[model samples]
Target: MTYPPQHAYPASRTPGGRCPVAPSLYGPEPDGNALPAFYEELRREYGPVAPVTVAPGVSAWLVIGHREVLHLTREEADFSHDPRRWSLLREGRVLPESPIMPLVGWRPALLYADGQQHRRMRAAVSEAIARIDGHELRRSVCATAEELIASFAARGEADLVAHYAQKLPSQVIIRLLGLDERTGQQLIWAITGTVAANADSVNASRRMGGILSELVAEKRAHPGDDLTSTLLGHPARLTDEEVLHNLAVMFLAGNHTTVNWISATLRVLLSDPAFRSSLAGGHLTVDDALDLVLWRHPPTQHFPARYATRDLVLGGRPIRAGDMLLLGLAGANQDPAILPPDGAPVVGNRSHLAFGAGPHACPAQDPARLITRTAVDTLHHRLPDLRLSVPESQLTWLRSPWSKGLESLPVRFGPRR
Candidate 1:
């Protein structure tokens, strides 16, 4: 099948025609390669609030403008992150009444929850993440980064995505969660495979979920002072199943997003010599690097899907209770009204929606930022000559619309001193 060029828009969006609104928008099959490009053009044509079909029988109001997305994110009354709501709207059946709900018995976590439950989960996780001594975590992360760089620097070559970007975050997260090396690797593989943009990777995710379920049971019987244990200890508030669900979410969310940021950031750095020089000169701190990375290329291109719980008006469009809403985080980030011109590269001290907004925002933002900052800083110091081994066009882009990331990134650099 031929994919559209990077800038082509869908023909139906043009004048005097009704766009196909059903399966084209909401069907389970992966969206066409032209979708992102189409969305870009629609943003130009329809402004921030555009009508799009996300799945079959599931229409959504796409929020493309930065300010509007921010408003929707913070306005819990208008937008609901509850998967049950979305599933009900898409399937035309209430979630709890569905067979899957009974079999899986999914519970909403901070990412998918709102109100007091979300607040409590965020508060608990935030307290733990914030209390982590940055300096100490940085030291450990730096050591890991340095070791990784040393392994590849001598060859003057590396798959930056695999050798450094992917490795560092998983290692740091495993250490932070106090998981054994074997289990940590298993978790990483499961999360990565399950969430891959490729449809072929779905089976891997299923297998990983099975393993995680078993691991959750083990943790219950023999708990330790890790994040898992902390979650389990709060049984009054969270059920055992809820604890497992949250852990699975955390593992998948934390691992891949950080990995994507690092890979994309390195690609950006290699392409922009001035940025690389600035980083090497110590003009850019870890926080600065993270901000730039996030602003330029957020890991998740689309916001977590949300459903309208009640009739509402967004961007002057009437949104029914069952309609799906695809909050375009990437599109929002680039919205000219909310951000500076697209040509300007991100520098220091800017906030973007890479971690999202409001109650459903990623709870692990602090730790993620810390891990990314440490990896970038450590690499810049240790591998001053690091550069991509392959041409940019040769690098593979993951095809899924859910996340923006590279499949692999090969690089060449001078040997470690």
Candidate 2:
């Protein structure tokens, strides 16, 4: 699953052009960290499938049931990923300039492709990611994490979210892609701007495209042992434009989700004493902590619109042709069908819908796991006393409809002597 680009919140409306009476899931809450509660409420009130407004004049079903999400995602023939099939966008109600376009907009990337084309693109991406050496990547991630933490270790205090969590993933991905430091820096800025989806988003999108195009050309002329070059040499024989778009997909999707995953893992490590003590007492491992976060506070709360290719009923709700279905990933993980009521998160359960399911499941989960675990492990090793500087309640989550990214993670620890 991918994140919806950050955008301004407009007024709310449901389908059929009527004033929205259903719960709206696209705006900020009075409590910045109330996403869990909100998901629970939706599930309790609507019985797993609830009518919700994604944007003004945009109505969709938020599928909060675990079984339903699995069925919908696996049956790609019935529920396709191609946004071109969305009825709202087709009827001129959802305009090109709409803020949600960055999410549901048609792209030539793997995220939007379907059927045979999706298989081809997915194979290319999966193969490219598979070729990377896991041990080498882990070592690179650990080293990057060490450098990031050392940069702030002497200060005794820092926003780990900004200084460490966000930077480590980008640097690791850049190294994997075999890009230079300057270009890597530029990619970071361009990606930030593009996902922000503000006045600069259009320019940021163009800038990112230009950067990817240049990298593709460079790799074509002088191939190297990197992801871009690997894609260029793949048997898929993807065109230059295809290479650029797929690279964009990998970079953009990989960085955003990994950043949030890192931040969320750190939040749990710092805020929950029992959880920290579990690690200290040897009752749990970092991998267990990671799994808990995946099940409880997933990096991506809700995935973007998946259009229904035909009329069908899911979770007792009738879905029409071309109707939008937003996968309630965090909600589904909390479903009683999977996790017993009042049950704690299972230590090694990897069945959560956090990375998605079926043919379109995220292809880079292994790399993401390595980066997150190494980052968290390195941080604790560097500063064992690290703790939150501010009260946990004072910390806020970024108010976006897609991912549960922390706004900042202010932390303090014993300064290095």
Candidate 3:
């Protein structure tokens, strides 16, 4: 965002020629694991449209082609995101705690809606989020990052995940929604569980919903300049439940995505020496690093659940009615057909589907980038000599394709310079 783009074109169009066919066999269960290695394995074994299990006994097409994902994301009439439209969910196949269920399941939020309903819900969310001015957001993020950094700067070493990365976004969200400390902490836990989609996720989701409902009610009773009050006062006149669910969507998606964005960006800065040196030497802007991370790591590995409205053929693969399609955001970014002839992505080629495209594209990307870049710049400025305490190989990531999240980012740094 702070740097010029490599090129811009209508991402609505498909790449030249036909899609290369590969075996449509099911490779493995998705299990919501967001690993670069797994995405590479899927790309190598199965071409553009490959089959994979989102949960045990639930297989769907993972759209790995860049053009294919854009097409499906753009074709709302053909591909529905509603989980209730999903045949497997109706058949009771997805367990309550299934890792992918929380995302795939229907909620009255903009993320799962389509057509007029989606537009109506999105108006309020977009309007409310748009009120977040960039300058003020940067100020908040910088202050939060500085406060967080000061706590650990004297220690000479700290887990950025525990101290800065995770908490920064949570604190930002708290400020955005204007929630108290106790409620914000509870909300963060609930969001973590819902995104995790494992056992206890269902309960966690309900708790998050309850928290959102309370926040909405409080905002309704007494207004403020925060997002909660903005939504409540919006002309959309959304129902209490609608407002609650929408807020939950914001919390779930915003915090969850930002935490990973921050963590992965920090990981890249701390782990990749050459890349870090480029920034240190002024060859790369912070936005450049963030853009690369967005393409390669993305916020989520597998963008979940778009059900087929009718039978259709995609990338030479048979798609049946009610079949779900998971867009491989990470995989699609590497889709060779859409890449340069060298099979490598040129820097600043945002043609990647990191924020997705079409009607459901992320509405809050600018805010996300601002928060991430501010956090990154603040950290690097305070801890110029920051370096990873462990090798990249030894670091463990949270097994979540829903969010490509790092579990921890431990690092050692010289005292503030």
Candidate 4:
């Protein structure tokens, strides 16, 4: 699966007239897991904008500076959310089946639209999401969290990643979408397979599309009081295709990112003594820990990013038209200029690029935080004695190009009393 050296697709030249080799940003390489350090290295070597390859021969820039990332994501006029602007994909250099395609590939969803069209598409989603009852959503998250924890409480030991963090969000989202349990199970399967971007990614993606299409059709006819029905009836006048894709966006974005956020936050809570003591001693809140994780272990590491709409200079790197730019969310949060002089976590700052910023910024941040907070609070309330089952060193990170998540968070706690 290797390709020629990254120097083959360099964005700029070195002082010696040779192009600097862009490092690979994919695969199970060491950087895939220890991304914060990897990002630091990239920054040291290439400043704010570093050239990197995503898939084999798929070259792009990884924006690592805090300000640069802000500009890249915020200035939609200069960069586009539309993947059709991607030069490599447009010219057929990137294979259709490349694992990254499921993420960066275009759909009719607002996630890929721009300007007026983006505003139109986003209004429907934002309104639909807003229509959700906040108290009810919190209750569902608490009940789901308790139910999930109860399933594993008596076991004394469990992999929280699978048994709790992973299930709670999917189940809650299923309920929000008014999906039957069977359909919900299919949704979970399709989401996991597609986002994991394995050999079956393309097929899994198609399956997800089918599932969303059916849900849209069913909701259109029945028009329940669920999120799907809300989208269908929205005043934005979204077409069936628009509603389908937006629901897909909502479902996909809500589930996986929340899963990672919960898992990573729990990892920090379990492993870091200072965090635990701070929470226990009332110096910090669950919200603080969640914000810290957002900064330090952003759910997605390098976000699938904007395409240069026209030639431009960014962070002093000459970005040609149609060039891809991966938003280094974790890297930007770690930017030296933004950190304290002593390099400590900025406990209360909620301005990190974890959910990104600007028009296409994640519209579900509050819901995600609510879900994650309720899940963490419920688990600890039920099992105050919870502790890691394995040594911290034994925990493994999921080698996802996009996500920063533990593969599992095995823990031991007292049996239900």
Stretches of candidate 3 off by over 4 Å are 1-37, 343-345
Model 3 weakest lDDT span, ten residues long: 9-18
Candidate ranking under TM-score, highest first, comes to 4, 2, 3, 1
Winning model by TM-score: 4
> Which pairs clash (backbone N, Cα, C closer than 3 Å) in model 2?
none
Estimate, for each residue in 22-103, the C-alpha lDDT of model 1 and write its tens digit: 2223223333234456557767666666776532323456677777787778888777767666544346443333212211
Residue range 122-180, candidate 2, lDDT tens digits: 88889999999999998898888878877988899999888988899999998888789
Off by over 4 Å in 2: 1-13, 16-19, 30-32, 197-199
lDDT string, candidate 3, 1-417, tens digits:
011211321111111112323222222223224255565676665556777654445677788878789888999988997888887777776676676676677888898899999999999999999999889988899999989998988889999998998899899889899899898999999888888756777888888888888888888999998998998888999888888888888888888888889888888877778889888887877788888888777877778879888866676565677877888888888777776887553586677788888999989888988999899998888888888888787676675545546788889987652
Candidate 3: C-alpha RMSD after superposition: 6.9
Q: How many clashing pairs per prediction, in order?
A: 9, 0, 5, 0
Per-model TM-score, in order, reads: 0.82, 0.93, 0.90, 0.94
Regions of candidate 4 where Cα sits further than 4 Å from its true position = 1-21, 31-33
Model 3's TM-score against the true structure: 0.90
